[model samples]
Target: MSKKVENLLRDICFRIKVKGREVLKEFPITPAQFDLMQKLYFAGEQTMTELSRMLGIAKSTTTGLVSRLENEGFVERKRRKNDKRIIIVVLTKKGEYVIDKVIFKRIEFVEEVLKDFDNNSKEVLVSLLEKLNNSVKRRGG
Candidate 1:
Protein backbone atom coordinates (compact mmCIF):
# COMPACT_ATOMS: atom_id res chain seq x y z
CA MET A 1 0.00 0.00 0.00
CA SER A 2 2.82 2.38 0.74
CA LYS A 3 4.46 1.62 -2.58
CA LYS A 4 1.16 2.08 -4.33
CA VAL A 5 0.69 5.47 -2.67
CA GLU A 6 4.21 6.52 -3.56
CA ASN A 7 3.75 5.52 -7.17
CA LEU A 8 0.46 7.36 -7.33
CA LEU A 9 2.02 10.52 -5.96
CA ARG A 10 5.00 10.42 -8.27
CA ASP A 11 2.93 9.71 -11.36
CA ILE A 12 0.42 12.42 -10.48
CA CYS A 13 3.13 15.04 -10.07
CA PHE A 14 5.08 14.07 -13.16
CA ARG A 15 2.02 13.81 -15.38
CA ILE A 16 0.69 17.17 -14.28
CA LYS A 17 3.97 18.90 -14.98
CA VAL A 18 4.49 17.28 -18.37
CA LYS A 19 0.87 17.52 -19.44
CA GLY A 20 0.65 21.16 -18.43
CA ARG A 21 3.59 21.99 -20.64
CA GLU A 22 2.31 19.86 -23.47
CA VAL A 23 -1.17 21.37 -23.49
CA LEU A 24 0.18 24.88 -23.13
CA LYS A 25 2.03 24.54 -26.42
CA GLU A 26 -1.01 25.68 -28.38
CA PHE A 27 -0.97 29.05 -26.62
CA PRO A 28 1.10 31.95 -27.89
CA ILE A 29 2.43 32.98 -24.51
CA THR A 30 4.94 31.07 -22.41
CA PRO A 31 4.05 29.50 -19.08
CA ALA A 32 5.59 32.47 -17.30
CA GLN A 33 3.41 34.85 -19.29
CA PHE A 34 0.30 32.84 -18.47
CA ASP A 35 1.31 32.88 -14.81
CA LEU A 36 1.62 36.66 -14.80
CA MET A 37 -1.65 37.03 -16.66
CA GLN A 38 -3.37 34.81 -14.10
CA LYS A 39 -2.01 36.95 -11.25
CA LEU A 40 -3.09 40.18 -12.90
CA TYR A 41 -6.45 38.80 -13.93
CA PHE A 42 -7.31 37.48 -10.51
CA ALA A 43 -5.75 40.30 -8.49
CA GLY A 44 -6.92 43.17 -10.70
CA GLU A 45 -4.69 46.06 -11.66
CA GLN A 46 -1.33 46.26 -9.91
CA THR A 47 1.79 48.35 -10.07
CA MET A 48 5.06 46.86 -11.28
CA THR A 49 6.29 46.56 -7.73
CA GLU A 50 3.14 44.83 -6.59
CA LEU A 51 3.29 42.32 -9.41
CA SER A 52 6.97 41.73 -8.88
CA ARG A 53 6.43 41.09 -5.20
CA MET A 54 3.52 38.75 -5.82
CA LEU A 55 5.39 36.79 -8.46
CA GLY A 56 8.61 36.71 -6.44
CA ILE A 57 10.47 38.04 -9.43
CA ALA A 58 12.92 40.91 -9.58
CA LYS A 59 11.69 44.38 -10.49
CA SER A 60 13.63 44.48 -13.76
CA THR A 61 12.39 41.05 -14.77
CA THR A 62 8.84 42.10 -14.04
CA THR A 63 9.41 45.18 -16.17
CA GLY A 64 10.47 43.06 -19.13
CA LEU A 65 7.54 40.71 -18.66
CA VAL A 66 5.20 43.70 -18.50
CA SER A 67 6.77 45.13 -21.62
CA ARG A 68 6.26 41.91 -23.54
CA LEU A 69 2.73 41.55 -22.27
CA GLU A 70 1.99 45.12 -23.33
CA ASN A 71 3.43 44.65 -26.80
CA GLU A 72 1.51 41.41 -27.20
CA GLY A 73 -1.67 43.31 -26.26
CA PHE A 74 -2.21 41.02 -23.28
CA VAL A 75 -1.76 43.91 -20.89
CA GLU A 76 -1.66 47.70 -20.83
CA ARG A 77 -0.50 50.31 -18.41
CA LYS A 78 -2.99 52.79 -17.04
CA ARG A 79 -1.90 55.86 -15.16
CA ARG A 80 -3.22 56.11 -11.67
CA LYS A 81 -5.99 58.65 -11.21
CA ASN A 82 -4.50 59.72 -7.91
CA ASP A 83 -0.85 59.62 -8.91
CA LYS A 84 0.36 60.17 -12.45
CA ARG A 85 3.78 58.74 -11.71
CA ILE A 86 2.45 55.28 -10.85
CA ILE A 87 1.24 53.07 -13.69
CA ILE A 88 -1.18 50.26 -13.01
CA VAL A 89 -1.13 47.22 -15.24
CA VAL A 90 -4.53 46.31 -16.65
CA LEU A 91 -5.51 43.38 -18.82
CA THR A 92 -6.96 44.28 -22.18
CA LYS A 93 -10.04 42.61 -23.66
CA LYS A 94 -7.78 40.56 -25.90
CA GLY A 95 -5.80 39.52 -22.89
CA GLU A 96 -8.94 38.44 -21.10
CA TYR A 97 -10.12 36.43 -24.10
CA VAL A 98 -6.83 34.62 -24.46
CA ILE A 99 -6.74 33.93 -20.78
CA ASP A 100 -10.24 32.47 -20.87
CA LYS A 101 -9.42 30.24 -23.78
CA VAL A 102 -6.21 29.05 -22.24
CA ILE A 103 -7.98 28.34 -18.99
CA PHE A 104 -10.68 26.37 -20.75
CA LYS A 105 -8.12 24.23 -22.51
CA ARG A 106 -6.27 23.65 -19.29
CA ILE A 107 -9.45 22.66 -17.56
CA GLU A 108 -10.27 20.25 -20.32
CA PHE A 109 -6.89 18.66 -19.91
CA VAL A 110 -7.49 18.23 -16.19
CA GLU A 111 -10.94 16.81 -16.82
CA GLU A 112 -9.40 14.31 -19.16
CA VAL A 113 -6.79 13.36 -16.62
CA LEU A 114 -9.37 12.79 -13.92
CA LYS A 115 -12.09 11.27 -16.03
CA ASP A 116 -11.81 7.93 -14.37
CA PHE A 117 -11.85 9.31 -10.85
CA ASP A 118 -14.96 8.74 -8.77
CA ASN A 119 -16.77 11.70 -7.22
CA ASN A 120 -15.38 10.88 -3.79
CA SER A 121 -11.92 10.50 -5.17
CA LYS A 122 -12.21 13.83 -6.95
CA GLU A 123 -13.18 15.50 -3.72
CA VAL A 124 -10.31 13.85 -1.92
CA LEU A 125 -7.93 14.92 -4.65
CA VAL A 126 -9.07 18.51 -4.37
CA SER A 127 -8.68 18.41 -0.60
CA LEU A 128 -5.21 16.98 -0.87
CA LEU A 129 -4.26 19.64 -3.39
CA GLU A 130 -5.51 22.35 -1.07
CA LYS A 131 -3.33 20.91 1.66
CA LEU A 132 -0.36 20.83 -0.67
CA ASN A 133 -1.01 24.45 -1.63
CA ASN A 134 -1.02 25.43 2.01
CA SER A 135 2.23 23.58 2.54
CA VAL A 136 3.84 25.42 -0.35
CA LYS A 137 2.65 28.74 1.06
CA ARG A 138 3.99 27.81 4.45
CA ARG A 139 7.32 27.03 2.86
CA GLY A 140 7.22 30.36 0.98
CA GLY A 141 7.13 28.79 -2.45
Candidate 2:
Protein backbone atom coordinates (compact mmCIF):
# COMPACT_ATOMS: atom_id res chain seq x y z
CA MET A 1 0.00 0.00 0.00
CA SER A 2 1.05 3.58 -0.60
CA LYS A 3 2.09 5.87 2.26
CA LYS A 4 -1.07 7.97 2.00
CA VAL A 5 -3.34 4.91 2.08
CA GLU A 6 -1.49 3.48 5.04
CA ASN A 7 -1.75 6.77 6.93
CA LEU A 8 -5.46 7.04 6.22
CA LEU A 9 -6.12 3.53 7.45
CA ARG A 10 -4.08 4.13 10.59
CA ASP A 11 -5.96 7.30 11.43
CA ILE A 12 -9.34 5.67 10.91
CA CYS A 13 -8.45 2.74 13.13
CA PHE A 14 -7.10 5.04 15.83
CA ARG A 15 -10.21 7.15 15.79
CA ILE A 16 -12.43 4.09 16.07
CA LYS A 17 -10.47 2.79 19.04
CA VAL A 18 -10.60 6.12 20.86
CA LYS A 19 -14.29 6.54 20.19
CA GLY A 20 -15.04 2.99 21.33
CA ARG A 21 -13.28 3.58 24.61
CA GLU A 22 -15.16 6.79 25.15
CA VAL A 23 -18.46 5.05 24.46
CA LEU A 24 -17.65 2.26 26.88
CA LYS A 25 -17.24 4.74 29.74
CA GLU A 26 -21.02 4.75 30.09
CA PHE A 27 -21.11 0.95 30.43
CA PRO A 28 -20.38 -1.02 33.58
CA ILE A 29 -17.10 -2.39 32.21
CA THR A 30 -14.08 -0.61 30.84
CA PRO A 31 -12.37 -1.61 27.60
CA ALA A 32 -9.70 -3.65 29.39
CA GLN A 33 -12.24 -5.43 31.58
CA PHE A 34 -14.32 -6.28 28.53
CA ASP A 35 -11.19 -7.61 26.86
CA LEU A 36 -10.48 -9.95 29.77
CA MET A 37 -14.03 -11.16 29.99
CA GLN A 38 -14.24 -11.77 26.25
CA LYS A 39 -11.03 -13.76 26.27
CA LEU A 40 -12.11 -15.87 29.24
CA TYR A 41 -15.60 -16.30 27.87
CA PHE A 42 -14.32 -17.73 24.61
CA ALA A 43 -11.25 -19.62 25.87
CA GLY A 44 -12.69 -21.07 29.09
CA GLU A 45 -10.93 -21.05 32.43
CA GLN A 46 -7.22 -20.20 32.48
CA THR A 47 -4.45 -19.86 35.02
CA MET A 48 -3.32 -16.43 36.16
CA THR A 49 0.05 -16.91 34.49
CA GLU A 50 -1.63 -17.96 31.27
CA LEU A 51 -4.01 -15.02 31.30
CA SER A 52 -1.17 -12.59 31.90
CA ARG A 53 0.78 -14.09 29.02
CA MET A 54 -2.23 -13.98 26.73
CA LEU A 55 -2.92 -10.34 27.62
CA GLY A 56 0.75 -9.35 27.50
CA ILE A 57 0.41 -7.76 30.90
CA ALA A 58 2.44 -8.39 34.04
CA LYS A 59 1.14 -10.82 36.65
CA SER A 60 0.76 -8.05 39.20
CA THR A 61 -1.48 -6.04 36.88
CA THR A 62 -3.48 -9.12 35.98
CA THR A 63 -3.92 -9.85 39.66
CA GLY A 64 -5.41 -6.42 40.28
CA LEU A 65 -7.79 -6.72 37.34
CA VAL A 66 -8.84 -10.18 38.46
CA SER A 67 -9.40 -8.95 41.97
CA ARG A 68 -11.61 -6.09 40.84
CA LEU A 69 -13.63 -8.35 38.55
CA GLU A 70 -14.04 -10.88 41.33
CA ASN A 71 -15.17 -8.18 43.72
CA GLU A 72 -17.74 -7.10 41.15
CA GLY A 73 -18.99 -10.72 41.10
CA PHE A 74 -18.14 -11.03 37.42
CA VAL A 75 -15.38 -13.60 37.86
CA GLU A 76 -14.51 -16.41 40.25
CA ARG A 77 -11.18 -18.01 41.02
CA LYS A 78 -10.97 -21.68 41.79
CA ARG A 79 -8.25 -24.13 42.72
CA ARG A 80 -7.66 -26.94 40.27
CA LYS A 81 -8.94 -30.38 41.22
CA ASN A 82 -5.59 -31.94 40.48
CA ASP A 83 -3.29 -29.10 41.49
CA LYS A 84 -3.89 -27.32 44.75
CA ARG A 85 -1.16 -24.82 44.03
CA ILE A 86 -2.73 -23.52 40.83
CA ILE A 87 -5.71 -21.23 40.56
CA ILE A 88 -7.90 -20.77 37.47
CA VAL A 89 -10.31 -17.99 36.61
CA VAL A 90 -13.88 -18.70 35.68
CA LEU A 91 -16.71 -16.42 34.56
CA THR A 92 -19.78 -16.10 36.73
CA LYS A 93 -23.39 -15.81 35.57
CA LYS A 94 -23.10 -12.08 36.24
CA GLY A 95 -20.12 -11.90 33.95
CA GLU A 96 -22.04 -13.67 31.21
CA TYR A 97 -24.95 -11.28 31.58
CA VAL A 98 -22.75 -8.20 31.45
CA ILE A 99 -20.74 -9.56 28.54
CA ASP A 100 -23.87 -10.26 26.55
CA LYS A 101 -25.10 -6.72 27.03
CA VAL A 102 -21.70 -5.22 26.30
CA ILE A 103 -21.24 -7.23 23.14
CA PHE A 104 -24.70 -6.36 21.83
CA LYS A 105 -24.11 -2.67 22.47
CA ARG A 106 -20.73 -2.80 20.80
CA ILE A 107 -22.24 -4.36 17.69
CA GLU A 108 -25.00 -1.80 17.73
CA PHE A 109 -22.47 1.00 17.89
CA VAL A 110 -20.56 -0.39 14.92
CA GLU A 111 -23.76 -0.76 12.95
CA GLU A 112 -24.67 2.84 13.68
CA VAL A 113 -21.24 4.01 12.58
CA LEU A 114 -21.59 2.16 9.27
CA LYS A 115 -25.17 3.10 8.54
CA ASP A 116 -24.15 5.47 5.79
CA PHE A 117 -22.22 2.85 3.86
CA ASP A 118 -23.87 1.18 0.89
CA ASN A 119 -24.53 -2.56 0.87
CA ASN A 120 -21.66 -3.39 -1.46
CA SER A 121 -19.23 -1.24 0.47
CA LYS A 122 -20.30 -2.84 3.74
CA GLU A 123 -19.78 -6.34 2.35
CA VAL A 124 -16.43 -5.41 0.91
CA LEU A 125 -15.31 -3.83 4.16
CA VAL A 126 -16.30 -6.91 6.17
CA SER A 127 -14.62 -9.27 3.71
CA LEU A 128 -11.43 -7.25 3.65
CA LEU A 129 -11.32 -7.13 7.47
CA GLU A 130 -11.71 -10.92 7.70
CA LYS A 131 -9.06 -11.48 5.08
CA LEU A 132 -6.67 -9.04 6.72
CA ASN A 133 -7.21 -10.63 10.15
CA ASN A 134 -6.59 -14.14 8.83
CA SER A 135 -3.50 -13.02 6.96
CA VAL A 136 -2.07 -11.39 10.06
CA LYS A 137 -2.74 -14.50 12.16
CA ARG A 138 -1.14 -16.76 9.55
CA ARG A 139 1.92 -14.57 9.30
CA GLY A 140 2.23 -14.18 13.07
CA GLY A 141 1.89 -17.90 13.71
Top-scoring candidate (lDDT): 1
Clashing pairs in 1: none
lDDT of 2 by residue, 1-141 (tens): 669867987887776556555645655676777778878998999999989998999999888889988998889999999998999999999888766665665667788989999999999999998897797799994
Q: How would you encode candidate 1's per-residue C-alpha lDDT over 57-83 as one tens digit per residue?
A: 998998998899899898999999999
TM-score of each: 0.71, 0.76
Question: Which sections of candidate 2 miss by over 4 Å?
Answer: 2-31
Pairs with steric clashes in candidate 2: none
CA displacement after TM-score superposition, residue 105 of candidate 2 (Å): 1.5
Off by over 4 Å in 1: 1-27, 123-141
lDDT for position 132 in model 1? 72
Q: Assess each prediction's global lDDT (C-alpha) against the native.
A: 0.83, 0.82
